[model samples]
Target chain A: MNNHENTAIEFNQVSRHFGEVKAVDSVDLTIQDGEFFTLLGPSGSGKTTCLRMIAGFDHPTSGQIKLHGRDVTNLPAYDREVNTVFQDYALFPHMSVGENIGYGLMIRKVPKSERNRQVRAMLELVQLPGLEHRKPSQLSGGQRQRVALARALINKPKVLLLDEPLGALDLKLRQQMQVELKSIQHEVGITFIFVTHDQEEALTMSDRIAVFDMGRIVQTGTPSELYERPRTSFVASFVGTSNILSGETAQKITGSAQNISVRPEKIRLVAPETETADSFCAADGQVTAVVYAGMITRYTVALAHGQTMIVAEQNLDDVSKSVATSRGKQVRLIWPCSANNVLQDPE
Target chain B: MHYKNNHRPKTPKGLLLSAIGVLLFLHLPFAIVMLYAFTTDETTFTFPPPGLTTKWFGVAMGRPDLWAALGLSLKVASIATVFALLLGTLAAAAVSRSKFFGRESISFLLVLPIALPGIVTGIALRSMMGLVNIPFSFWTIVIGHATFCVVVVYNNAIARFRRMGDSQIAASMDLGADGFQTFRYIVLPNLLTALVAGGMLAFALSFDEVIVTTFTAGQQSTLPIWIFSQLTRPRDRPVTNVVAFLVVTITAVPILLAHHLSQRDNL
Candidate 1:
């Protein structure tokens, strides 16, 4: 981990309250320089509020926010060295694309000639050359998003804050823009603090993801770590599809493994009469239902104890031949001991 | 789909009749004024004038008293419009965007003059000016006009400001521009059309104001006051019609122009 001194943004026990409701509660986080950090949460989880505070749009009710070791807790938004791409893009409809991109430079009192040059370069950088004369109303959703990005990046801010920037786009366009945004961030080499409720988007773009719940950070880690070793049930369910089984800790099999969390894909299905004894732990059940997805077959198995378990099988050749025939039949479900992930119970 | 189809209007004639009625209600008075402006008769209005002539235009333009009154009205309206635009925009920005105490009450007071009847406001202003011992002059007329005119500008400016998302301001500030710089480069440009429309509307309102102007102008005669005085004089009948016609044209042009500008903004 990078030291706190080298961090681009550091929130020291920051808290914000809106009337009696705590929107952000004592969050302490360090975003490293030139890294893509994401705050992921459900609606009203306070991710956007935290982003607003960092952008200087909202001041924390208590605690400090430091940018490059300088306290900026009280600074107004315009005084901060950061720019934001809002969810709606919020491009000025009255101004042409060039004027929108040139606004920051004009505000900084850059000479007209230099501002024009920089604006032209940024237009080309966003692959939107010759769109200078077009108003925002004339542009498509993706084009307007590009113009917004260009407008923000033209100033080369120390930190770029994106509040659900791709939320307004169609799914296909959003996926494409996510790649473009990640590449753009890489090229600019600025710290990006992104906020989104989309888990797939966070997983695809962030160097580290912070999961928020009810105004507090529940967990923070890399995409793989968050998915494979989610510390809590909320993180596990939020990040990916997981079939949760309510079971007490049966026993501590070893010092390192305290609880069991088996991924569906890890379980192997076998006919009850043809099971290998030493290959895995066994659970016997009747197939309650079978569903055929494009890439996989999902099965709901009912155990004798009335517990239901979900098992997913990759449809390598023919899904019909592999799992379709087992519907309404008793079967043995098996998985290696290593397939289970042990997680601490959330308080 | 079936429900929507069943409820669809069956009588296109009814729709046409209502549309025509609304159009006539809106434009009939203006059309009458335009028709009478060219009348050659001196005593009373007739549907078809004896003959169309520019005689009244000539008579109205040739009077020095009428010219002086027009000039004074223009002077007062111009001063009031400028003051209203400045103070109205500032007050709008403060109330619309800032989080401060008494915001709702301040906004309410800003719009109070317009909400009340013109006679009430005029009477109140007359009493206040008398109590303060301030002589009623062009400045007093400007102040009275501005009380209502500010509401026009404030409504326009505040509506535009609220429609503007906060992100645009944040983005500009984040790019290293100060508050003034952000407003100048980002905010003002967005607000320009609305401000112009509001100013034009305020100018129209101030230019044609009679009830408030009468109470505020102690000795000075604005164009409306001049026209009101001429209504009682038999010798000045044609001239009064001409001046009234001119006042309507002047006021109507700015208001129409402002409407066109605001419509374009919506588009």
Candidate 2:
């Protein structure tokens, strides 16, 4: 056990089951202090369950959880020094913005004047200044989310758990909140455990991320580390899009009969007869389909061995080497051999 | 509240006539009762009275028996409403938040008192009181009224609990509040409006309740029991009409208030 004050939260083989369904299987992990860590997974991957157990809203079916190096598995949420920003921004509809932000302090029986001052300060931090008198129902979705953040942050908990806090916002607002939330986490210097299924969000703001699947933690690493060197097929395919190669094609590409992953962005478009470079692996294929996505174009290349790979390239201003107009053209797919990540053998 | 653009106000002529006809059919008798309370003649029905006077209202107000019955009814209804609010909210919170064995059956049983024929509930309560050798009195009337009032509050509160969603409670807990604190700070506020709506409806129903009260009250004289007995007496007819008007107003106020309170939440 690496129990220490620097570790904000640690799970020791914690598992939770609801009768027939195993919501979260035995999992071990540690979140360090003042680090922005994210749990990334699709729905039903048990990431939210893990966050709930940490917040003390749930108890593990077996094993233990420690908060700030103290065993809090049996502790209630009120006793735990952790707060959460919910997905729907669960602000009290009846209370004004200031009252909602000041709720935690009010519950703690803080002085009225001090609570108001702290609420105002927290509101300013979230950039929703001087709107405390307005009801949550009257505010827009983005403003309500900011109030939720302020309310949770005012408690000044050791760790803040954000469960898809930006899920309710529109695309533009979500991107904007992403940057603001990251900066606020840095400013507050609280250990943050953010949960999201959006891989881009995880990659953008997280100092490190844990990928989950089927009630287990598949991999844990920095965003680039997981993106560039996923140790398993699920992590490789889930973190960012990857062209998975196995069987004979895997042997031909890397001289080993092992599953490997090559990212679509890593493959470059080259001439049909280009000679393979010492540092890069090369293969010949026919461009079967092209998909235009405004700034970039993706080509589905069907190799000689009946395997298909998706290759994406920037749609530069020069129109000559464009994949959009290169349909049915023979091409060579090449990427640095070092870019290919060998995944563990499938069980 | 901003539904002006969505209004489809052009009702068909046939539907409009039918709606008006239905409203009049339901309310015309109550209007007649109000009209009779002001009739000058004591024992006769007239198309237009020789003179309309407020003398019956004065007579009804002066009677000591009438005051006693009104006081008893108000006391019973208030006590019944209090018990209903407590037990109904507890039952709703349990059924809505936790999925345990027999949850559906418990919910169905909670609503059974109101759904079944009042005579059936009266007979059931009366027989149980008899088997236990419990004397029928003011307390029995309150208990009888509470049986159905609990259903009213439970129905309203349970629906609100479901619509309020589960995340609000989770959010409260995650915000450093325990179960009691979560209820006080989060759950209670959301349900306060709903509880008010339910409590008012329960009060209105208990105030006007007649059948169950008759079986439960052995010697106690409630307002409805007095009204029932007075209907058989020929001399106090106009006074009975005046008291009926007062009862109708007392019951109508809470129903309308509950409607207004619950509707405001939709906005």
Candidate 3:
């Protein structure tokens, strides 16, 4: 684990209130140097607000923010060592692609020749070379996103903030840019604080993910850690699909007064006559619904005495007609004890 | 491409006649003025003037009063347009970007100068000048013109600001640009064409402004004021017609140019 001095950004009890709305509640977090950290949540969940404070677009109403171990809570955006790739790209319409990319250098009084060289180099870094004089209006959506990234990365700031930078692209383009953006972060070695609401995007590229909810960070961990061992029901259901167990059914399974979650993939279906392992928890249920997704079949099973759970099975072999019609049939649902993860009831 | 007879909507004859009737009603007098500028009969409005000539053009150009009034009008219009552009853009930036107490009223006050009767505005300005004990001079004329001129630019600027949401400026700040630098590089470039359109319209409006200029211009003659004085003189009727023709062209050209520019921006 990295020490405290290696932290690139630290939010210390930061909060921003707008009259009656707490746009960002007290958020305390430390982003490691050269890490790809994501702030993931739904819209109006304060993910973007936290990113704005780090970028110095919004000052916290109370508490402090440190950049590279220095207090910069009140510093203006220009003085901060960070750049952002905006969601809409926001390229200057009046300037050519080259001028837009080199704008930061121009603002800092860099000479024209050096600025052009850096712009060309940055363009190449984003895999867009030699198409400098074209206007932003003429470019396609994906091309404009690349230009936006190149423009922010040209400055080589300590951190690159991305606010849903791939949102404007279609799904195929978004997937392609996700890979490209991850590789770019690796090459630049800059701490990147990305804000996105898409769970798939957060899972794919982030080294660490912070799930925000209603102006607060609910959980922060590596992608798999968040998925497998969520501390709360919100994190469990939000990070991935989980079958939540509550009421007396949860007490029967865990032998404690607690709620629990089990991943759909971890639950298995077996005939009642089959012998079970001692380490596994077993339940008798009838399949209520069957969902046939391409590579998997999902079963919505209702356990005896009323709790419903979802179980997913990979199509390891062809599902015969008998297996497909098991929607109304009785079955034994079994999963290893390790798969039963206890979750705290949400506050 | 020619429209197919089957696809075209048939126009009623009454509507067609009314369209031309409205066109003639609006522009016929201006056409008559242009025709009179070329007439040989200087003192009378005879049918077709018996002959067409270009002598009044030279006569109007030779007068010193024409030169002084033309120069003063140009100067006043320019100064007023500049003043309007600066204040109007700032007010627009504030109004469009921020939500504050009485924001709607601020917008209302900015536009009220042009929306109210021009004579009422003129009276208010004249009385304000009297209360402040500020002597009426060239600056007073400029202030009066700007009271209405600012609204022209303000309307254009605020519409533009609303279209360009807050994300652009956020991106600029994120790219490490200070406020002034962001305005110079991003905001100003995007705003240039709109400002040009609004500025030209303001200039056109200020150049021929009469009521406000009457209250503000103390013993000074703008081109419109000079034209008002020329109306009663029987001998200089042809020269008056020539100057009126020039005024119409001067004002109409900018408005046309403004329209063309703003239309191109939309595309």
Tell me the lDDT of model 2 at B44. 68
Name the better of 1 and 2 by DockQ. Answer: 2
Q: Which ten residues in a row have the lowest lDDT in candidate 3 chain A?
A: A1-10
**Full ranking by TM-score:** 2, 3, 1
TM-score on 0 to 1 scale for chain A of candidate 1: 0.92
lDDT (C-alpha, whole model) for all candidates: 0.86, 0.90, 0.91
Q: Per-model TM-score of chain A alone?
A: 0.92, 0.97, 0.96
Model 3 ranges with Cα > 4 A deviation: A1-5, A270-275, A317-329, B1-25, B127-137, B215-218
Best by TM-score: 2
Per-model TM-score on C-alpha atoms? 0.88, 0.94, 0.91
In model 3, how large is the Cα lDDT of residue A138?
Answer: 92
The CAPRI-style docking tier of model 1 reads medium
Residue by residue across A233-281, what tens digits does model 1's lDDT show?
7887898766455543223222342545667887878878565556466
RMSD of 3: 3.1
Worst 10 residues of 3 chain B by lDDT: B167-176
**lDDT score, candidate 3, position A131:** 77
